[model samples]
Target: KNEGSYTIGKVELEIKLVNRGHVSGNVKGGNFFKASGFADMFGNASKDYQPQTLIETPILAENLKPGESRRFRVVFDYPPYFKGVTQFTRIFAH
Candidate 1:
């Protein structure tokens, strides 16, 4: 049937913000909190693009032990192009 559909050929403004003053890095002593990775801004989406959980930041870590080095700040509200995947493909093909 070939019922596959997706069209967003291009939308690469390439926006990246790194306040990597310290996401975490101390080595041996321990404190490598750059867990996995994440920083948003992308929507050439085809289906399902779940987004919820706006903001929350609070990491005391019982007065951080080991080699200390922590500074956190994350901001997000992506959409400089693809207008949120073309407004959901114009409301799913009207």
Candidate 2:
């Protein structure tokens, strides 16, 4: 959450993904990870507090068997004008 009146700065995040499913899967083609900024922890927003697309990028193609894991790094340039409000971030894989 940005406690300041102005945009704080860029936030970098690292995530570790593991394939715990029984079958092997491949991360290829258009598979991607996205990060979204929300107004609150519940992921709700109003007209004045809209959701922001922090970052979105395609993941490198890799075949992961069960128990295999991969690391991903992402940088999000925090949105401006969100002031003194609680903020939340959510990551999605598709």
Candidate 2: misplaced stretches above 4 Å? 1-62, 84-94
Query: Which residue window of length 10 is worst by lDDT in model 2?
Result: 17-26
**Per-residue alpha-carbon lDDT of model 2 for 1-86, expressed as tens digits?**
33334432333333333222112233343443233323344565355644432334444323433344456555435444322222
The number of clashing residue pairs in model 2 is: 0
lDDT score, candidate 1, position 83: 18
**Each prediction's whole-model lDDT (CA):** 0.28, 0.36
lDDT (Cα, tens digit) per residue for candidate 1, span 1-94 = 1122433222222223222213232223333223332423442253544332123233322333334434544344543322121111110110
